[model samples]
Target: MKIFLTLLTSLFLFFSCSTDDDICTDGEGTPQVKIKFKTFATGKPRTLDSVFVAVDYGAGPVAVVQNTVATDSLMLPLRVEDVPFTDIYVATSSTGNLSQIRLNYTTTSEYVSPACGIRRLYTGLSATLQAPNPVLAVETAQNEIVNESKTHLFLLF
Candidate 1:
């Protein structure tokens, strides 16, 4: 009867309405740069006993990695602002010597999805090592950061 039709319509309407849980699960977003440490003499991968990293995203130095144990590679997030460069300080230990590294690049925004929005892709990537001690030199690997699957920079020690 009329009551059955009204209940059916109500159920259909409730089921058809989408909720906020319909989110983007495509894993499409800003990618972090990956850096690997290597031996300066043999040019082989080297593992650090302990590592400390601080990055200046514009405001001040912020500790991103603190006392990481036995890590050969590092994943670093860059600045997404209007700046053209990011400064990072790396140390082998908590009180070890700090080496300053400046990463210079140009960014381009790409539209990923509606939920993910736009992501910044860095190009013309270059690095400068200002201090020499635990970290000696810098080598560019990929030069462009489109994804996080490959090594972007090599820190020679």
Candidate 2:
């Protein structure tokens, strides 16, 4: 009787400790949008000496990249909160020319794991280029950003 009680208690403890927390370690989250730079005249890939990217608000602007040198490609993060729309501003220099790009997408809750709960996944991606645009054109290579390898936009300047 003593041996049976001990075994039962051990099994119960093992099962109780093994919860969803152990299985949710591989939870995936939203990925950043990739942008590739190109020459407006040549239509080929080019590198910028420095570029600034940020989100602007009525009061001020939040900087994503400030005076950072980017070669060929850059990964820009999108807003993952409850908001469905994100507006990003990009500049070639610190006090040089700038442009604004608006990204509109739909968000859906995805079940990652019980421990991780849910994460927001964006789809139906679209972009709008605003005035004072320094870019020659914008091309969307990938509309859905599921991984880091995905290139969302190509900017020609």
Candidate 3:
């Protein structure tokens, strides 16, 4: 009878000590802003041979996209702090001729899960092309950035 009770207690303790609820598996997190490139004349998609992107979150500037191959879409992460805008720099080449673009938006935090913590969401999105050289114009596609599935902005070249 004592052995049976000990086995039962051990089984109960092992089953009750499970920590599966602490693991976040839904992939709920901050979403990145998606930008697609298009030609200014034809209004069609344009593939860049070499593209470089840098953004300033809090510190100076940090490179986000440095690709040598041709690509038409880019994913950029916004600022998570209390700043209302994010400054981005795009360059067709790595040497010079960097165009500045500022992304303005309002951020809100939502609780995802215990393990995932809070995630930031942006709304009222707008873009201003401060320098127009390689990038001719900026177009806002989506006003809110809730997920990475949709294009938020379009860069006309």
Candidate 4:
């Protein structure tokens, strides 16, 4: 009886003191986002007309004017920093899913961004956007960690 009790206590102690491995640890690194666009996004795939690429910048779209290089083959411009994408509306220009533009000009349409501001001039929605909660006052930054059924990650921008 004494031996059995001793063994039971030893097992309980060992199990209780066991350490757990962190399975959901995402190593410390820069938080980055990839902008995925659709094929219909590239206006006039083979033309020299400017195609605006706007970034909402978490608030709304910011105009980044850039023109497409009329390539002999399937070639895409490196970036759009000059075309005037801000507030401009393209029926269906930029894509949510990234893909190469297929010409026939069926998908090519006017570029317009849904930004509300002064007429004849539209601004990106991001400009007037507001963070849900800037900071929890004094709390400044909030980071919650969980190793159970649910895990929440709050990364700083």
lDDT of 4 by residue, 1-157 (tens): 9999999999998786623332213321111211122222232212323243344433554544343643111111111223332222121233322112111101112222223111121112111112311211111111211111221111111
C-alpha lDDT (0 to 100) for residue 16 of candidate 4: 68
CA-lDDT, candidates in order? 0.90, 0.76, 0.91, 0.25
Q: Write the per-residue lDDT of candidate 1 for residues 1-157, one digit (tens) a residue.
A: 9999999999999997664335655446788999999999999999888889999999998999996578889999999997899999999988989999999999999987666788999999999998887899999999899999999999999
Better of 1 and 3 by lDDT: 3
Better of 2 and 3 by TM-score: 3
Model 1 has a clash total of: 0
Q: Which stretches of candidate 1 lie over 4 Å from their true place?
A: 1-21, 24-26
What are the runs in model 4 whose C-alpha is more than 4 Å off? 1-48, 68-157
> Which residue runs of candidate 2 sit more than 4 Å off their true CA positions?
1-27, 56-60
TM-score of each: 0.86, 0.76, 0.87, 0.18
Instruction: Give the candidate number with the greatest lDDT.
Output: 3
RMSD of each: 3.0, 3.5, 2.7, 21.0
In angstroms, give how far residue 65 of model 2 lies from its true place. 0.6
Instruction: State the weakest 10-residue window (summed lDDT) of model 4.
Output: 99-108
Better of 2 and 3 by lDDT: 3
Q: Determine which window of 10 residues in candidate 2 has minimal summed lDDT.
A: 18-27
TM-score of 2: 0.76
